[model samples]
Target: MIPIDFKGKRLVLFGAGRVARLMFSRFPELNVVAFADNDSAKHGTFVGKVPVVQPEALRHLEYDLVVISTGWWESITAQLQALGVAPSRIVLPPKNMLAINNGEKPFSHAPTKALALEVLGCVADFSARHAIPIMLDFGTLLGAVRDGDLIPWDDDIDFSLNDHAYPLFVNHLADLKVALPKPAGCDLDMTVLEAEDLITGVAVTYRNAVGCNAIVPFEIGFMRRVIENGQSVTKGAGPSFIAPEVHFHNVGSITFLGKQFCTPDDALGYLSYVYGDWKTPRQDVTLAEYPMQESEYLETSRTLV
Candidate 1:
């Protein structure tokens, strides 16, 4: 990704919709030139005081980059390209349609005991290499193993880095796979997160696809959030800690391989946020076991490479 030098550069964005508002609200530091949309009604409208313009008006100003901020990637990309915007100068937000189109769904399996341990190994290696802080977050905090069997859960291994360590992690991610998520099609999957410190960093999540008899894979992306003010903080504004909800009626069957897989309710709440609006059996446990011994600011020592 090219470094955004917004010092005096103009950022012309297309489609002043929800996604655009999300980006504009999150990153107010950038110099926004204006909004461009095909709808004639919005031509003279203003999005947060940034004037909306017709695409024809774009030629009047020299813009550093044209951002396709619309969620409808296919349509927006086509529109921007039709305006003769050089493909190289057109940038889409991370995890936009282009990025999703670039990769395939991961495969699913009964994760091994070694899986979580492998993440731990990666964290140890990453910490040694970077000499930075990384925390074993959320589900990964559940102890390494209990009672002779690996905790069989669909969750992915996750870890966090301070803003400073993020770039180094991204730059060397390929070489450090042993300390990071295993080989997937793309080298690194990136998402910008909101943090309490207002410091930006990437939380790495692993993915697996677990649909049998289906031609195209059904993907499950592992989810993780950063630790702030002694608890986990999500992508939402501030002071957000994951509060697990328990649903306990349907146990012993969580719908895996045509049979219900055992997913605890508290686990389900966390997974709900991770996977986005999933319902589980019922509430079993609220406070699931985590790996860290709570310390100052409730930080966990566990990490990923």
Candidate 2:
């Protein structure tokens, strides 16, 4: 488990659900501001006098640590990420605790496939209705889904829009009923373009860039910008197609740890580049192997999936 130093940092809590109450009782020394949740029913209520406020009210507040104390963990994480939370700020109890708990309500410790599919559906529906185009992305276990049927251990979905369309996403969201979860770096979410490097995988899913972990909510609106430039176009002839491919530049190699890793980046990079950048399509690359694929080429790869 990763240990976080809380010696002299501002911390906040969200959701006054059972988990929030339990955590507060156990770690009273932590500087907790109050609770933030989507349930309107919980508004005006207080958890031990820490007010249960709506998410919007705390958007401008700053915090070094934000604890997610909710059961719909994956969905909450998605909302938070959209708002601009950093991935390292979120967590749940270890797998041991998760395995043993069997209460009236199922405990969600991390993002699950069930959650991934739901998020995918939600984003897809929203984008389509608003005429927003998206590139359906699959990564990791999601990649396996594309390669075969292997179930990945984690959960996430990917959809990416180039630099131009992000602002429109923010304007659209500003008028919605959606409620974002406040987590770490919530106030800094507006700085996503500057705070972190935008990493892309030549052969992985879009969500893979922002996988499991804690993040904050952003109202500055990169997503809206993405939606604005996305458009729908028809495919081949006789029938009508509404999905136009979103525009993206082919990034040659990704620099990590001060080193540039080329695609056919992995052996898969070879296949993806061939099928994509090089314009020479290869039917499933996972189907066959240069056999020692894992040990030969991938053995020394240092990038963390």
> Per-residue lDDT for 177-264 in model 1, tens only?
5445553332333343433433234445443344322221111122233444544433232113343322222221122222222233
lDDT of 2 at 14: 61
> Model 2, 1-305: lDDT tens per residue?
11245435565566666556765665556566767788799988887767777766656767776666544455666776676667676544321111111111111323333333333445445555665444333232123324332123222232344444444543455322142222332121111221123211111112212453332110111121122224322111111112222323332233322222221113344334223432332222221111111111111111222
Provide the overall lDDT of each model, using Cα atoms, as 2-decimal numbers.
Answer: 0.45, 0.37
- What candidate 2 gets wrong by more than 4 Å, as runs, is 1-3, 93-305
lDDT of 1 at 63: 84
Q: Which candidate is the best by lDDT?
A: 1
Candidate 2: Cα lDDT at 172: 57
